[model samples]
Target: MKIVFYGVITAIALSCNVQAAAIDFSTAWYQVAQKNDALQAKKEEVKYSQALQDAAKSLYLPNVDITGSYTHFDKPISVDTPPVGNFIPSFNVPLTNQNFAHSSLNAVLPVYTGGRITAAQDIRQAQVDEAQSNYNLATRATFTQLVQYYFGVVLAEQVYQVRLDAVDALADHLNHAVKFEQQGQIAKVERLMAQVSLDKAQIEAQKSLRDYEIAKLALTKMLKQQDSVLPTTPLFVNNSVTSVTPYLTKTLTDHPGIAILNAKREQAKGMVDMASAKHLPEVMLYGNYNLYSDDSATGELLPEWMVGVGVRIPIIERSGTSQEVVAAKSSVRQVNLLQMQMQQDLSILVEKTYAEMSQALEEYNSLASSQALSEETVVLRQKAFSQGLSTSLEVADSQLYATSIRVQRLSASYNYVKSLAQLLSVSGDIDHFMDYLQINGIEVK
Candidate 1:
């Protein structure tokens, strides 16, 4: 029985097909719709924000404008004149021109803007950095989804293989049943039972294929690919599992979820700065060069210019900049509170996933041992039946046990790998997944 069990194990190992080219997870991850859109939109937002920052920086630079106007008056103003050479009575005379035109070139350079320019630039800069954090969050979110779907396909493929093995084993049993019936060793009813089991196994294999196809199609859609992908990564548990202490310590600074929130908090703080800037007055230096045609008083064309300083003092702000400052401060407090809640939730999620990972690892290890025993039992029962020392029902029961254990082992393996990956994902350290596998000396094809 032991020899037969070893031979079966060898056969199963030898039957494994050469693995396909592995899908580059990094490449595939970039293709998912949510991540792609978030990344692209963030880039556009950065451009927009940079433009705003540039505009803010230009506040110190001078602004120049050109203006022109024409006017025709029905009655022109009269100029009061005194007698020049003689002691004549003072008189008034209407200006000859009734048409007038003026053109001007004006420029202003801000000396100060109540610190609004600086605050606005700071706000825009913070927003750009915040956009980058948002992109990182999107990446991590999409990666988490990929981990599930990616492993799902692998599990479905394993199930399909199990079903195929069961069907093949049942077909061989049906052949043996026919031979025994013809030789008068087994009843015709026994042969009918073998045929029935084979039919059921075939149906189950077909169903397993359907499930595999569905998983494959779902993965294809996520990748935005024209063809289905075959995952080359094997499912296996890390025997050298480590503690989650480092992850929790780093979560606040490194976790993409937390990073996004922190960035928002900084932006809100800048909002307070922007709102408070309105309390101070604005000052600017301005110059205007003017040309006039046919002035009513002088009846002469001339050009004139003025350069001066301007100030807009704030006396009463009816819109209440104070309220805006208060609101901005409240937003900071609210985001900080949300950040606290998220921290708590993340810690809980890590602990729960770690616990699940440990359980899956235990189940996986236990099943590995149970599978060998189940295979040995099936072989011994089959050998007994071949020697006429056991009934067909006894051999069939052994085969059923073997098949059940095989499926369970597959499930355990998948669960262990999936949970371990999930733990890293939630901790915002999925990049360390390969390191975890390496620690356990597991190789992925």
Candidate 2:
């Protein structure tokens, strides 16, 4: 008994794992979004962020330099002739093959920059924020599109199945009606009705098949793969949008577009600071060690070294202060307007999605009831016709109605799922979906 129980448990566990491995819509959608071509551009944005950080740190390091120079002499002076070599200069010093070598090491350390470094660092940090915001915006847009495409394919498949079932039911009814008419149990008109119903059902089935094929192509395009038979899976839905209001508010507050503008505004302010500081003086501490060698048969002058400090007071920079100030003010104004526009747009989107979700939920529920009732009517009408108490037309009509209701139900469900996704997207909860995908172990590819 223990062995049998263990075997059953193992089988159940494997089956559960297989089911869990099925492609979840939320997971597949996010994976496709993350791997999208747009994300590549966002990744480049992240690179720009790192670049900004590097630029900011650059000013902190001391400048070190090593230099060597060679000079040729038209006429060489004889230092041995007199003191300070003055006698050789008037006594006709002869030109000779002479080479002088000098090498130096220099270092510059900034004692003060009048806030130039501070302004520069602030600008770079703002740049990083801008890049991050742009990346986030692209990511959100891609996620929205992937959700739409993924759900579209799944819903199309369901509609196709519903139409197929309709065709089968109509075929069975038509076959029965023909036998009844031949046996003189039903009128020829009733048999004709059954035939017409079958024809209509088949037509609808063909159309649904075409739609299914198109949906497959769409899904394949999104995933960047070849179209083939799609696997069956239950549609995942977040029915509790009300429960996520707090999340929605949080995301909207920190939306990437607004952040991008804020970053730009900050950069503009930094530029203004930089421009103001440009008129101020900068102090630098510098040191240098020089080595010079004079070679001779008798004796040689040894190497000499020197060190110093310097200061640069900016009395004037041609149009530097005025131009930067103007640019900075203009940039700040532009960013402020951009932020306002984005906020307004987001508000409208949130309202529209909320309305859409409400309508979709109502429609889905209505279609669910209609499908159930239509299905029951079909069963009853078919049984009544077989007993010779109901006309063939009644059975055919009920079957067609049932099939159409099923299709409507599928469409309603699909729309509801999409509306919910759109709501989540506006609120910036897409990462939640991505996390679900990673946890499921389903790789994007």
Candidate 3:
């Protein structure tokens, strides 16, 4: 029976190892970039902005229209002339017919609009800029999320391995206790205590397995993969200390959020220009050609074709163009203030994340000696128990202590990795994260 149980366990482990597909961080990010809906939406927004820009540019083109109309009068009007009674008779001259039909083709080309068109084009360009920045921001955000999920799986797997080791160690101790009690060398209570500790370890191992499965599921779903994913990148930490100054400077200069705000401010300025243009005159070149005329008089009165330059000066507007200008200026000020606040908030966030990364690294380093010591103690206690020099409880306690240290160290590494991702994301330097990983990352053993 014991052989059958051990065989089943080995088979299950082998199957799991075969089924999970190991992927590196870069490949995982590429998969996510291709599959993530939110990132695709942002890309579409950029295209939409580009279309708007084209539309704005089209405003410079002339507008052509064809119009036709028919009209009926109450009566035909004419003129009568009376001549000398004796010499000639009176005659009537026709002026117009009772019905008239006419058609015209017209074109209007803007010569100048007091900068209204220019302002509109500028605003549209700013919108394009803002859309591009937003897309970049979305990309960075997705990358950061991927980092968390990928490392989460690694950490869970490591923890589960530690739990399995603890279970194996306690099981050996329990077997020894059972044998000593049966040989009349130890009390039966000692055997029972060992059984309890082994049961507890088994329960913990089961919990860790559940956690590992959950983490794997999350990563698989993120990459839109049907098969289970195993992260090739381990949880890591850099022992070297990094300064926050460079991160802060880079964040202030290159952050997408800052770029978005700058775009908005420019858009607001464009609005102000557009509003002020309302108080100025517009110049246009207009032409009309008579396409058709049923009546000869109408054709003679309306010229065959006419062209003229037209000017429209705004004398009065009920909507108050001045108030519009004021509102637009106020918007510019508002955007400026928002930009300042965003910079401040981003700086603070960078500092906080940097500090957390440093702390996790320090904690991980500090636990190294403790982990070694605990591991050595576990081996010593197990040997002493086998020689009848130490109790089973002491061996179980040492095993549990070693397991706790391993879990804590793994947790610290995970924290460091997560914080580093966040710091890079906020600083607009997430693109360099893989470089850092390659240069500084020390994989947890």
Model number with the top TM-score = 3
Q: For candidate 2, what is the lDDT?
A: 0.70
Model 2 agreement with the true structure over 320-435: per-residue lDDT tens digits: 68888888888889889888888888777777777777776677666767878998999999899999988888898888888777767666666666666666666777756544
Q: Give me the candidate number with maximum lDDT.
A: 3
Query: Where does candidate 3 stray beyond 4 Å?
Result: 1-18, 74-96
lDDT of each: 0.73, 0.70, 0.88
The 10-residue segment of model 1 with minimum total lDDT is 12-21
Better of 1 and 3 by lDDT: 3
Candidate 3 per-residue lDDT over residues 252-318, each given as its tens digit: 9999999999999999999999999999999999999989887656556888999999999999999
Sort by lDDT, best first: what order?
A: 3, 1, 2
Per-residue CA lDDT of candidate 1, range 5-74, in tens?
3355335433432332357454566467444565678667768777877777776789999988777778
TM-score of decoy 2: 0.79
Minimum summed lDDT over a 10-residue window in model 3 is located at 1-10
Using all chains and alpha carbons, the TM-scores for the candidates as numbered come to 0.85, 0.79, 0.93
* Full ranking by TM-score: 3, 1, 2
Q: Tell me the spans in candidate 1 whose CA falls farther than 4 Å from its real position.
A: 1-38, 82-86, 93-96, 291-303, 389-391, 443-445
Model 2 per-residue lDDT at 439: 45
